[model samples]
Target: MKILHTADWHLGQLFHEYDRTFEHQAFLNWLIETINSEEIEVLLVSGDVFDISNPSATSIKMLYTFLREATAQNSNLQIVITAGNHDSASRLEAPKPLLESSNIHIIGTIEKNSDGSINYEKLTIPLRNKLGEITIWCLAIPFLRMGDYPSVANASNPYSEGVTALYREAFEFAKTRMSDNQTIIAMGHMHTHHAEISDMDKTERLIMGGVECISATAFDSEMKYVALGHIHKAQRIGGKEHIRYSGSPLPMSFSERNYKHQVVIFELENEITSLKTLEIPVTIPLLRIPLKAEPLENVLVELQQLHDKNDFEQAPYLEIQVLLEEPEPALRYKIEEVLKYKNVRLARIQPYYPNKKESTSEFNQQELLHELQPVDVFTKSYQAKYSAEVPEHLMELFQQTLIDVNQTEA
Candidate 1:
């Protein structure tokens, strides 16, 4: 059986203040072609199908349109998608009855039985071969929230212990329904302790509680392959080749402009699996000015030289980093005027100034009001309110909230 894994689509996402309908549509189109060409029998999307729990009508349309087109192009293909933290569980699974007939399975939340017990049967999905015989059983687990995992009394790390227990139980349950020759695989949307994060961007920040990162040992070693999500960089978990994150297909932020956005494809035969990655073609480019923070005078020259590559219909997104001796109030206006006729969208203007004598905690009210960023403000407020440095998960939540607000306001 051949399986393709991808995640973090963030459909209907806006880059800077600009709509990304074009880029997303282009990707969906390319994905359909890849499905047809690769002869893939199954597709697994780990999570974060939408940028927010409540998505725009246009964004919702794009997803359904892609699904209809994809299934039409490949009749034998089966797609399994799970909801991430950004998705409203019920909303993503609302169309389940209508979609299952077409070989599309959407697992949004953990379903419980009338007796208040976790329904393991619903969590386990059977992967069938071309001959309509079940050859693999996939434990399709979504982004687990509070109360979703089993309660372990007096556990030091409740969230981590709960998650580990849930998976252990799920895996054990699958063993009963599986044949001796059938393979067992799993899917998850989480942050493992051994994962590496590209700290360059705030777009992929994922945190649920004070302690959300779990041990990679959450999954039993007996599982053949584990497809993961929630991190944007494609990488293997620890040293395990079969455990991996396929990453986002588009750059989530300017810091990730150079990330080789891709999807993972692997073929499983006779309990052995082989992995390969296919890079997604960039529909629109993301460019940085001067490659480093520089004086405005130098950055201007680079922008002027980029006029030759300008395309009004499909202009590249640009992020300018300016090193300043003093505040340049007209910096934005100047760049706007320079790019008036050029084919580029000014996304961000990052300014770096010389270090001040006062530390971040020493900033006055006036300075805090005008000089600090939303993140800085969030840090100060969280410290004042909680009387401690902000937890990484809280900061991640604040960052994710800020991104959502910015996208909405834009």
Candidate 2:
């Protein structure tokens, strides 16, 4: 059996303010061609099919259109997709009945029995070859929320323990249904303690914290392969080659500009013989001009040189960083003037200033508390934690949040 593994599509994503529709479409087209040419029998999409829980209409259309077209082009192909943290479980699984007929299996939410127990049978999916013989079994486990798993009475860590118990129960049931030579593969959408994260990933950290992460030992040792999602960097878990994250197909942030996005392919002859990576071609490049903080004059010179290059259609998305001791009120305008008629699109402009001097004398708590306003208290608390004053942009955001809260109360 030949299988392709990929995850974190994040369709409908906006890079800064730029729409990524064309880039995502190009990737989907390339994937279709790769599937047909490679003669892959199975495709596993781990999670994060959409950028947000409420996706745009265009994103939904693109996803289904690609799936339908891919399955039609390859008659023997089987696809298994599970819901990620970014997906709305109920919404993603709404068309389960219709998609199943086309050999596409989606596991979004856990089903419950009348007695309020989980219906474990629904989690086990059998993958059969063209001749209608079962070759492998898949434990399709989607992203687990707080109340989704079984209750663990008197457990120190309820969430983590519940997750482990869920996998154990599902794997034990699958063991009974397996034949002598059949393989058992596991699918999951949560973070494992053994996985590595990319330097650029900000969202995954918010989704997968220390309290939410499960250990790699939660998976059964007998399983042939464990396909994981959530992490944007391609990596193996606990140095085990069979357990892996295929990563995102596109760079999610400017920090990931140097990352080589790819998908993993597994060829299982008897016990998973070969593994290979096929790099996804870059449809549009992301560039950080100067690559580091530089003076305003230096940045202007680089921008002028870039304009002279005259690379129009394929010009990369640009992020500019300016180093200054104080604020340059017209910095963006200056950069835009320099980039006039340049091919590149300005995605972001970041200004870095030296840290303010700290007070040498420490005041008593009583004196400080008496003089502080509500906003002052908040700023002091933030400075104590981060060791810096809140940026002007963030302070503006905080004021807006206060306004929103006041309106809600009113």
CA-lDDT, candidates in order: 0.85, 0.85
Cα deviation of 129, candidate 1, in Å:
0.6
TM-score versus the correct structure, for each prediction: 0.86, 0.87
Worst 10 residues of 2 by lDDT: 356-365
**lDDT score, residue 134, model 2?**
87
Candidate 1 stretches with Cα past 4 Å from truth are: 200-204, 208-210, 308-310, 356-410
Off by over 4 Å in 2: 307-314, 356-410
| Candidate 2 local lDDT, residue 39 | 91
Instruction: Please give the lDDT score for candidate 2.
Output: 0.85
> Which RMSD values do the candidates have, in order?
9.0, 5.3
- Model 2 C-alpha lDDT per residue in residues 282-400, reported as the tens digit of each score: 98899888888899999999888875437554567899988876656689899999988787889989877555445322332544576766567767765654447677986897889
Pairs clashing in candidate 2? none
For every model shown, the clashing-pair count is 0, 0
User: Which pairs, if any, clash in model 1?
Assistant: none
